[model samples]
Target chain A: MSAPAQELPRPGGFPEIKYKRNIPKVGPSGLTLLVGITALCTFGLYRTGQGNLERRELEREKVWARIHLVPMLQAEADRDTYRREVADKAREAEIMKDVKGWKVGESVYNSDRYQPKTYAVVP
Target chain B: MSTYREPTLPTGKFVDPTPAPAESAHPEVGATSAPLKSAAYFIGAHCKEYNEDFMLCKNENADPAHCLKEGRKVTRCAMDLITKLRENCEKEWVAHYQCLEKNNQEYYACRKPERTLNECVFSKIKLEKVIPGASGTPIHLRTDSIYS
Candidate 1:
């Protein structure tokens, strides 16, 4: 080998933090804190979890959301059924109008909510 | 029709838990406050009002990161343990109603609450005169609310 290898010099100018090998593995204060934290966490979790075993609904909420979901599904199905029934009746009565009455553009029936509703008396 | 494979959940799978607090913490520094309360602050933040009552005392000069590191480790362990314990009971709850119909479900009454509960009038109904039990002393209540 030609010239000996050289180690890089310390950078431009900040004091470096020194590490002491002989420092106590864990300072006494830190150990004490850790013990205390562990104990508190254990206790709090145990206490909080006690009530979780019950299958109780959050009855006090204002929305009462859980009570509504199933009914909402059924309502959707029922609406489809009503729509089909109305359509069939309209065909039987030989009635037709510009559909999509709910909006400003076309007039499906006399009312927007239900187009050509129940043409029983055939208006 | 496409062959349907159940979609993999976007969320990561629940990992098998380990003895976390002991391993996760910084070995040198430790907690300066209640371990449970601090950890609970992470998920169950609503319980924080009582933190002072449970905080652990520790040296001020200790590396602040050290104590926080320890606290995080313990908190992780605690949360993992708590979730595991509640797994079976954490399923979403369902409610049923009889007086409703399919489309009627969408009716104004279905979406909005049709009923509410007030305090039961019989809340303090006394079955019998209070008597001493192994744990505490006895007390009594009168029968009628209006008088005597």
Candidate 2:
């Protein structure tokens, strides 16, 4: 009987196929790319920081300018109040010219009850 | 049924109105906010003494009447500064303030025109914009800033 078919030898050899893993290495171009990316990122961060700082400066200046002008503005408002008081008095005098014993701006009520209450609830 | 009666108005007593004399009276600064903000720093520089005096008067006296004269002086000083700025740096000042008016009165946005105006004012009147209580170099003087 012929040798068992399972024991038959394989056919003539072709070159063995090898599968190799690729390991990434940093060559000159790769190193240059890495450096370039790092630089760009750092510059972007720096620019953002500078922008924030400038904005802070602007805000500080605005607030300080307002603070500096407060007294002057308050003075202007006070002047307006004075002028309004004068105008109101003049208008009242004109309106009350015919009324006998009529006075402008004087409190007519003598009792504390007539005074406007300062607080909603008594302490 | 209750009868309805007309309510009588109270006759309030009057105090004599004390108006400032014609010679001493000064016209108020007519310019509004944008213009005022544009020239605020220069006004402060020019009218430091008057501003301080007015503030002092207000602090010393709670009565508005007592500080009226000082207030007038402050107003006059501000008016004078505005007039002088108009006379000397009209083009630059207008450009700066118009830029400010357009930019919601933000100083940084108008720094280009502001720089020009500041240069003109400094050259003409020798008044520099100095921010009070500011630490480090002023933002206007810096060249390295990325944005205006």
Candidate 3:
């Protein structure tokens, strides 16, 4: 009446298992879709960033928009107020450099002690 | 032309990046780079902490100089720090502005902290504290002190 319940495999189990194995285990590749989505998102971020940057720039211009037009005009009227306040020695130094024809954009980058230095970290 | 990359140095062949051989593999005890030892660096590093005590981030870099919005206690401290930065920036401008001629290299200059008040013991004393206006105290009272 029972060869044994455990031994009763009336279904086609062996072939089914082989068939499953024969089919690749990997899912459909989404490389193209992933690339497309990433590209679109990156472009959108860049576009949004452009507008945000513009807004920030405009805001910077508007801030202090009415802060002190009169005071600023008065300060400008004094013209050489900042220049005159400085000692004659300082003025001479500036003039001397100009007379010597030192170009502002010249290689004075090396002469400035405060010039930033490059750092190389040890491995 | 072969684009040469420095191959990983093996063992004894390790090349030190320093121009001159370092006196020691490690910087001497208590040694700090001069750039890392500036007051601006110190303040920038502790900005958030200091701002908590002093109203900072009151405005991002968008605000004009000297237009301090007076309200937050932390803002006062931040303004003090910003004032110092602007004053001493001429010395720092060359390095901070010059060295990295390309890209956002200038920002790297603003990233150091050397003048920290590590040893100072700070205590909060609330004076003329503005208690939130309750229904009973409809009018805001300005006491002689801002301390709460």
Identify the leading candidate in terms of TM-score.
Answer: 2
lDDT tens readout by residue for model 2, B1-148: 1135456543764433556444345567878888888888888888889999988887776556678888888888888888899899999999988998899898878888999999999999889998765657787777666667
lDDT of candidate 1 over B51-90, digit per residue (tens): 2112231132222222343344334443453343234212
Contacts from the true interface found in each model, as a fraction, amount to 0.00, 0.38, 0.00
Give residue A112's error in model 3 in angstroms. 46
CA-lDDT, candidates in order: 0.30, 0.75, 0.32
Q: Which residue pairs in candidate 1 collide?
A: A41-B36, A74-B102, A75-B102, A75-B103, B33-B56, B34-B55
Q: For candidate 3, write residues B25-103 as lDDT tens digits.
A: 1111121222222222333333435433222332333122212222222333434544544454434433433332432
**Poorest lDDT segment (10 consecutive residues) of candidate 3 chain A:** A64-73
The best candidate by lDDT is: 2
Clash totals for all candidate models: 6, 6, 21
Ranking by lDDT: 2, 3, 1
TM-score per model over all chains: 0.21, 0.68, 0.18
Give the range where candidate 1 chain B is weakest over 10 consecutive residues by summed lDDT: B113-122
Tens digits of per-residue lDDT for model 2, A1-123: 997668544587566667877789656797788999999999999899988888788888887667557666767776766655555557667767788888875545684232322321100
Q: Go through the candidates in order and give the C-alpha RMSD of each one to the true structure.
A: 31.9, 8.2, 22.1
At residue A61, candidate 2 shows an lDDT of 80
